[model samples]
Target: MKKIAVILSGSGVFDGAEIHESVLALHAVEKAGATWHCFAPNVEQLHVVNHLTGEATEESRNVLVEAARIARGIIEDVAKLNVDDFDALLVPGGFGAAKNLTDFAINGAECSINADVAAACRAFKDAKKPAGYLCIAPVIIPMVYPESVKGTIGNDDGTAAGFNGLGGQHVDCPVDDIVFDEENNVLSTPAYMLANSISGAASGIEKLVTKLVALA
Candidate 1:
């Protein structure tokens, strides 16, 4: 069986991982008959957010701890993810992805990915393994690829511009469509960036997972 590594940001849509996207990604993994191992960076979140109020809060949270909420307590520190244990990697979108996995939300194209996250993603890149990224998670595509890699984020101008700065070719995509960077073995979709419902997000996500597993 193919072992797919799932990297989650947090547990919520406001402060961490988008619940729908995260769950859907996992479903796609299972549907493909591939086992998935969850991983998260063991670090403090940039800050906490009250999802209901959409405001910053005073509580400090660990990225891995919060991510475990979504993984149902079965997850590992991304720093310890062994390349040999997984055939592919997948990242779901949420504010936490930009905030915790990489600082693209605050720093734009100049953002730096968390060291452990970078290492995990780079391991797949170095091994020529395929990866699937959804929503803002695709912002880190360039960081893992030396050449200009092609990806999409539902055509958000500012984000696309930032992707360009990071040495990536941003293609405008819709919620139901995906961008396949064949040479790099990378797949991405706009997902919630353009979806009005969970099913819409799943359309592209399912395709991405299918393609990624096939590549693996």
Candidate 2:
């Protein structure tokens, strides 16, 4: 059986991982006949947000602890992720991917990735293992891959420019499609970046997961 490593930012769409995207990706992985293990950085979130009100709150939270909520408490620290044990990697997105995973939400193209997160991702790249990145999570792709590595995040102009500025070639993909960098063994989908509904997001996610497992 193929084993996949899934990295999460947190449990919510406002400040963490997109609940729908994360769950959909996980389900797709299993449906593809692959198993998944979740991981998160052991660090504090950039800030907390009240999803209902769409407002920032003064509450403090740990990335791993909050991400566990999505993983059902069956996750490990990203620092402990050994690429040799897994066939592929998958990172679902939300604001947390930009805010927490790489600070792309705040710093855009100038953002730096968390050391542990960078290490794990680079491990997969170095080993030539296939990896799938969803939604805003593609912001981390250029940092992990070589110059001009291809990816997508729907068709947001500002976000697309940032991706290009970061040395990645951003492809304008549709909600139900994906862009695969065959040479780099990387794949990306718009997911919630373009989808207005869960079913819309599922179409691309399912395809990406199935392709990721097949490549693995």
Number of the top lDDT candidate? 2
Model 2 C-alpha lDDT per residue in residues 1-216, reported as the tens digit of each score = 999999999989989999999999999999999999999999999999999999999999999999999999989999999999999999999999999999999988999999999999999999999999999999999999999999999999999999999999999999999999999999999999999999999999999999999999
- In candidate 1, what are the lDDT values of residues 122-168, reduced to their tens digit? 99999999999998899989989876899999889999999889999
lDDT by candidate, in order shown: 0.92, 0.97
lDDT of 1 at 116: 90
User: What is residue 78's positional error in candidate 1, in angstroms?
Assistant: 0.4
Task: Give the TM-score comparing model 2 with the true structure, all chains together.
Answer: 0.99
Give, for candidate 1, the lowest lDDT window spanning 10 residues: 10-19
Candidate 1 deviant stretches above 4 angstroms: none
Q: What's each prediction's clash count?
A: 0, 0
- Model 2's alpha-carbon lDDT is 0.97
Clashes of 1: 0
For model 2, the stretches where C-alpha displacement exceeds 4 angstroms are none
